[model samples]
Target: MASVAEAYVFLTYLKVLFLTVTTYLTCTAHNSPTRPMFSVFTSYNDSLEKTHGLPTNLSWSQLASTVGEDKTSSSCQPVGIYSIQRHGSRYPEQRIITTYQTFFSRIARSRINEEFAYLKNEPLDRFTVEKAECLTDKGYNELLEISARYPARLFPLFRDPVSIFTQSSFQSTETNRTKESAEAFISGLCKECRFITPKHDEDKLILVMKDGKIYSEIHWLPILHDPLLLPKISSGICKDSIAIEEHSREFYSFKNSPFVEEVLHHVISRLDYTGDFSMTLDELQSLYEICATEMNLFGASNWCKLFSQSDLRAMEYLYDLQEYWYSSYGYRINYLPYCVLLQDIASHLESSVASGSTSTKKIFKFAHSTTIQGLFALLGLYRTSVIPTADNYPLDGNWEYRGGIISPYAANIVFSVFRCAGRSTLPNAIGDVKVLITHNEQPLKIGPCDSYYCDLTTLTSYLRSKVGSCDLDEICGGVVRDLPMKT
Candidate 1:
């Protein structure tokens, strides 16, 4: 409670402070040679569309195509389709919801700037900590669309009057969002299919050896515990300690970097807290999470308006660094967990080739982002030579290992085996089997395949070579042995 004159003076000071920060941001962006250069700032709408590390639609960007698809003949028939999908977009975890509660409570009381005035009365109905991490309506709808698109994309490979009935397998993690996502995807794939309700007690799909006896067989639905997917988490290893150490090292490096410091300084100054207020790393992370989650929930977010595209990009880089070190290409041990999954894929394809009509046609696994990231690491999809370090704020060249592109909500990897009858580019010595791998429905030229259609032997050879004598028990400190797959 201040006098009118004093209030006027404070408002004037805030205006000038904002102007100063804006000018500084502009000058630094233009003058600094090391800073990441973007195209001229045209419109805020354009910036809104650029989801740096946020959840975006599956078709946000068209991945580069290296194979000559037009040159290849359509004589090949799709023998089997193996896919591993991340859960659809959902509410952030409880921690982030708690962040929303804390930050918004403060924001509700604070005098917000004109740009973000909406936050003063923003809807807090769904921001409670208890209500979090479930798939949204938009997420379910998007999964339906994704399922529709995949069938259309691979329609050429589908047997006439495409059907997944009786020949398909679906699996998901025990998590609610994953199970819901799987249901949504299957519904879209084939509306008439019936599934046994996923119950923890009876729907357990994984094979277990109880007193040296086989306890289960092939499951039509997802398993409750998939060691292949949740290797690091399920294994009784202190991998978290190692991840924490690496994350802290890189996080502090970026947190202390000049660009990040400057951005945060401006952010605090812009927030216009009455007294000497300092922003913590947790608060900064919370702001970004709010922006990202809100954007997915609603088409627009006021939280996003606070940062310039360059500022947001810098923030995005921080998260990219986090994901890169903790999940992908951080350490060899980090990706060894996925070796079992890779071997499973190889075995599935080989079995399909050996047993023609009796094999499963489609196999879908609904999992988490870590599963996708680990698989990417094992396959060497987007590994960059330039390690994402704190000092390298804006990675120089076209850096590909982005969290948004790689493991956004509903991120997926699909492998299709095509049996070619006529002349093909693949060597005849290894049979006429070709494999195509796609990430979010984009053809990927990675691993043993430089082209779109990789030979089965080449793909399997690379996987086997990479997984040579891999022992999960040894890696996870003899905690758990690799569960044998039922042949």
Candidate 2:
């Protein structure tokens, strides 16, 4: 046998030779006339502008269109606004980071193919997975911009600077991200304003359940049951296991398709390496997640270049399906907590109307996307007529209606209540007050309401009718005898 140093030098030479040959083959194959050049680099910047699940960057014009032009409504004066907002972009969860690191380490140790040899030697310093659940700088800035722009957009409605009260979901252990988002929003609204971090006792605006105990800070007791309510009458409804399995199978089929595999192989083959190449489907998915999450956090990622727009759409659909089945309208229990939250909103609105305080003009809530999605589903916003199944995701389907679009980072829903001077057009008028609802800064019409503004009496009555007494204990804990799989 040769001495250790000689053996090391020989092995290094062999590795270099293998990489050179592999790189040459990859380049040749990619340059073939029959093969279309697939590169994300050319479109990466454009693609970032249209990423589905993360918050889409909006221009002032787009924001203006969403809130509508300040068409002078002589009869109505904005008295108060209630806004529910999702937290800004954040670092991947610890679990996601751990999975990504494991995949990267495996790639580093394995034999890399010619098409993916670049990955073997790629520096991971920029992609270092953060272990904490904190908001990225991008996330912070998104919130900052939103806060600064909102006052300007609503200027016509509320001419004077209004006092804002910011609140967030209360946890036994503090959620720093939610708090930080709330702080950023307050800072943007007015620099001198202080953020109110409500504890369980002071959080009367939103209901909180901890260890089977429900707490509410509000004193007004509205009727608890509303006919138009979103939560199931019974808790017997669970996710359809058959449907979930079918979805899984469909996802697997897509992931294992020749097109996807070719893309994966191309990515892996470019990684410079000396060993035999091998990668599992899970590892491939982890790589995609890294691309997606990194892009959302940092505005760009090289991993994004590994796939085309079609590939991104497929991945987006998969994530949408997951949220639909597990979080939004999927299971009966999935939206119960949000029901309580809705009740809280209604209670606060009613209280504001009763108190008639211009000093407390805005109610701002900061929460996770889970809260936003749950509330959206409960309100039937952007719901598909036919529930999406894993096997039947149509490429031509309405992408705008997807949950990814509805509850992206910094996603928000706003209800602006106005005190009007005219007689109500709506049935059972309670004075001349009206309410306008907006989602992601855009006005959203309630079912058959037709106009951007719904009569305050009509809106509150509808909400109260659906919400009834707004009792959390009864609604959350009540047992419905027989809940069907689908409403």
Candidate 3:
């Protein structure tokens, strides 16, 4: 046997030789005339700009045409606005990080396409285990920009900054990303505000003070185990097994479909993969996910170069299918879990209208994508006439749901209450208090309403009718644990 140092040197030389040969093969194959003319037709930036997939970055101008110029009726003066926003763009979850490491390792061991040669020694400093699931710098700025836009886009909601600050309440799920997102948003909303961190880690409420006076309060609620946001997990209103079963059936069926398989085959051919490793459908899909998330984090991704517009759309559809089945409009029970939250909002709106004060002027909750999707389902905002399945691709007017537009990072639902000049006998109104709801800064008409603005009492009554009397124990068929009382 050779000496230890000699053996180490010999192994290192072999490794260098292997990498050199691999690089040469990759470059040669890419330049070969036999190689198909397959490259990104639309640039990744343009593709991402047009993408309506779940991972699209949030922008204030995203719906400028669709929303048009500020359409708040001149006769209507804003009183209060209640909003629920998904946390801004965040780093990939731990599982995604782990899978990315594995994928890069596999690529390093293989003779990859020249376009993807960077994967052989891809630096993962941006997506370390320590940063898993935390909001990135880009994510913080997304929320900051969104919060700054409310004054102009939503208009007059923050006209009285002092009153708004004193009365408004901010809440978030018990997650670092959510809390950080809320903080970033508040920074833009209230530039001169001060925060009082809780003395105990167990404390949920944080006091907000301005000029030595208490301005408002921030509440951090439990996540995953929360009663209002994730009742499926908290109260067992929806069975996890059912979702899992449906997801598995669709996941395999769709991935194994002829269309999807053909796309996968094309990708494999372009990759010209030469290694002991065989990529599974799941791993292939993960590549799309990495491309999307990296785009969100850095405004671009090298992995995105591996795909064409069609490929991204196909991959997007897979996730769209997952969101449809798991979160929105897949089953009736999915909506039931959100009743408690809707009912709470109904009470708050009704009370705010009754009080007619800025105390309840702005109520903001920072939550997750699932929370927004489930809430939309509860309100019947986006529904499709045709069911999405592996056999069908509802590409035209048939499909109304697009995950990117509906529940993208920093997705929000806003209910702006306006005091309209009119003559009405409705209780607690000299004329009429109108409620205008918007999804991601664009008008979203509520159920059975022809226009974006609906009567506050009418809207509150409708919400109550849907879920006002929901009994968690009875609805869930089990005793639901309640959130601890705030100290």
Top-lDDT structure, candidate number: 3
The lDDT of model 2 is 0.54
Which ranges in model 1 have alpha carbons more than 4 Å from their true place?
A: 1-67, 112-115, 156-162, 191-201, 204-225, 238-243, 273-278, 395-400, 422-431, 478-487
lDDT of each: 0.63, 0.54, 0.64
Please list the residue runs of candidate 3 whose C-alpha ends up more than 4 Å from where it truly belongs after superposition: 1-72, 153-157, 194-200, 205-216, 237-243, 273-277, 355-359, 394-399, 478-487
Model with the higher TM-score, candidate 1 or 3: 3
lDDT of 3 by residue, 301-404 (tens): 67666565545556667677777777777755556678988987886776666635434667898888778888888777777776777778643213445677
* Candidate 1 local distance difference test against the native: 0.63
Q: List model 1 lDDT by residue over 1-487, tens digit each.
A: 4698899999999987875765344322322433322211111122223333222223212111223453442556566788998887777678877876787788777775555567778778766665587887767776676776655556543323235434667777877788778778866664433344333455544333333332222232333245677777665552432446644577678867777766676667666656565676677767767766665666456666565545666777777777777777766556777888888888777666663347676788888777888888878777786777777665333455577667777777888887777543443222477777777666677675767677777888887877766676676553322322110
Q: What would the TM-score be for candidate 3 when compared with the true structure?
A: 0.78
Q: Point out where model 2 deviates above 4 Å.
A: 1-72, 111-130, 156-173, 192-275, 355-360, 396-401, 423-431, 468-482
